[model samples]
Target: MTNSKLLEQFRSFYFRNFPDDMETQINYFSIFGGLGWDVDTSKPLTQLIEELILQNFDTLNEKIEQLTLNEPNNKRLLSALAVGDRKIFSAFKRAGLNNGNGGGALNYLQEKGIVQIEYSRESEANKISKHRISHKVLFTYPFIRFWFYFIYPHIREIKEKNYNKLFKSIQNKQNSYTSLVFEELSEVLLNYNLRDAQIISSGSYWDANMEIDILTVTDKMEIYVAECKWTNHRVNKSELHKLEEKCLKLGIKPFQIILFSKRGFSNELKSMQSKDLALYSSDNFEALLKNALNSTLIKSFIN
Candidate 1:
């Protein structure tokens, strides 16, 4: 199959696999894809965005609220979500691309009133702009932040261009990349568990210097630390040790350490599983994805 065709297939697979707000998410993924973000796409990025926003306005509103809560300061967060946190500036730069005419192919939906933006004036260098969905009827919504970061920059190579090197780069990251997506799935599951377990509080923990992935706190203040490893290599003792060290620095009791690995754990690690810690593999990841897909609450939202 052609490269674009394959991309389309992958897009379809992802949409069908995790169908919640599929079109909007797919468009979000595509915008990120075109910007060199991590997203599966099989069609023109702009077209995808256009179709999704035009088709669904209500669902887009919900995301807009989530994205827009504390305006002006959270602009960076919005940018980070639309694009990968690593490459958010590119999206920002693209906002003024056409001198406000959508010329450079990376126009800001915020400018169009589909997504709203607010600017902060704390520091000139640290200026912030918060974005939200402005349309109430759900015409089209902005894409997710991560999609714009990882998937949107490589559109040229994906659009009938001969770029083997580019394709290889994307392919190499696919396994671990998808693993990150699974990690996101896991977070949702953890949130559900938190509610079901009647845990009062949960907050994500991360160090600017190091990645902690997740940190959940219970009503009793018991902290559960999770390290999400989206790597092809199996989760092992050394990996667990790294998480332990970080937890120590956080000053939490470390009620449990969970490792979410793309490729399961090593035999040695498997032998070491205990109540204090556990390892979850891609198989479990698949189950999580399936459950999310089949969820009654989310069924209508995605389709």
Candidate 2:
């Protein structure tokens, strides 16, 4: 499919599945003056949210505070009292911390049992801490996160009645925005094809020293290092060389290398498509998603 067509389908799916997020984003932004957290109107929003975050902690001495003090029963109130709510993350991002406040809020939620965190068996290079909202707050938290980070900023355009341009911008950059989701999806899909591939453990990993998108460790200790590219371009050999050198410097691997692209592989790398080196394209990915999401042919596909 053409990139534009692909993006349209994805956006349709996202909106369909996440209608609440759309509503929340619109509502929040409208209330806070177009999601511009730096604006004067947002000052109250930030101060109020920081106070909420502070309520979750007990005077910095580490004593557990009264969890019931805020609303005592309302999930929304509890979320408001916690540190990593949409408001706080917005404040942090506006202050130039980027995703820092969002990350901190998520961590806080995990600590409060309002959400749960899990670690996968995927290799150290790719094993990421997967999070799920506790059943009580599942529908609410993700929508809140999506609102403040994804949809809120676009509020300005919507207010100015520039929806066509807003939608176009979202359409053009959708893949890059959702790249992390696709990377995780790719790892889950690859497991079925790796039966004879000596994979001891595989998962999404990220840390200070190493920042691999995906890492698969073979039983024989060979490491498969991957770089997932969501852009519309062929995967070239230089990227492979870069990944190979990175793995070598980390003191691991008679490396198995794979370059996964949303488009396809470059001509220079096509000749090397073998067991040891591999390239996967967007068409292949669509098939994987179809097989998993359509008929349940792949029972192990992670949603």
Candidate 3:
């Protein structure tokens, strides 16, 4: 579940001595993981960001600017990818870079260990599809991504302490903004929930046209496709239908189509659940924190 060393480090550090429940920690971690201080997870993120992030903007900005070596090209690419869909073409378009430049910039970012690429899975049933799906560029750390998306582009407002626009944007778009992190953590939770099977490969899947939020393969050749809904509304049958449609278009018969909703499923959707149709809510995400570090446990060992 902690797929990369950086992520493992983050989890260990973020959850070290001060601990909260899974949902509480995840909400704070998505926006403020890299901070040195232990965030008050009980407080709403809006208040915390205003008090912590906006107040300390200059210090945080300087550190990240140094990461890019004060290069406009790198900054532009990162901020673009941070706010945009993160597909290669979308990143270039957002950054206004030509293909050659975009490729060079991407290479530079990757070399610096700031971002990682996830290539689309095989889509065609029989042969390679002519359509070339672009790989997604993801930030190595959640905090960097958070900064680029929320702070980098709006430096003027932030510097002056004009938070009206920043707060407005966060209020309106925070759910969508947090979905990517939520989706990533949900994948980890799934693996934690299902430990018996040997996972061959696991990630989001995409083709020329459609995308599935999660696609996992097991050593036994079982396929699991899933949709993650991080919205206020409870999921319904239509959402499941959409996921099934994506699997059908990709010409793969999944062993099960899973649904992970932040809000619980609708009564209609709940009635439809079975072995082939699985469902989970944020409560299920506690699985991701199995064997979490405990300061008391460590003290006992040391003693």
Best by TM-score: 3
Q: What are the per-residue Cα lDDT tens digits for candidate 1 across 1-303? A: 012221332243454434344333432333332222233345443444334432343455445445444243234334433433322333344343222333212234444333332221123333235532111111022134332333334434434443454445445654444444444445645655455455554434433244566676667777777877766577788988898888676556787788877667889999988988877764453332343343322111122
Model 3, runs deviating above 4 Å: 5-10, 13-21, 123-130, 295-303
* Model 2 spans > 4 angstroms off: 1-104, 107-149, 156-165, 195-200, 218-220, 286-303
After superposing candidate 1 on the true structure, give the runs of residues whose Cα lies further than 4 Å from its correct spot.
1-151, 157-166, 286-303
Each prediction's Cα lDDT score? 0.45, 0.44, 0.76
Error of model 3, residue 90, in angstroms: 1.9
Top of the candidates by lDDT: 3
Better of 2 and 3 by TM-score: 3
Each candidate's TM vs. the true structure? 0.53, 0.51, 0.89
lDDT of 3 at 87: 91
TM-score of 2: 0.51
Better of 2 and 3 by lDDT: 3
Clash count for each candidate, listed in order shown: 36, 11, 0
Task: For residues 278-299, write the lDDT of model 2, one tens digit per residue.
Answer: 7876555443323323321111
1 or 3, greater by TM-score = 3
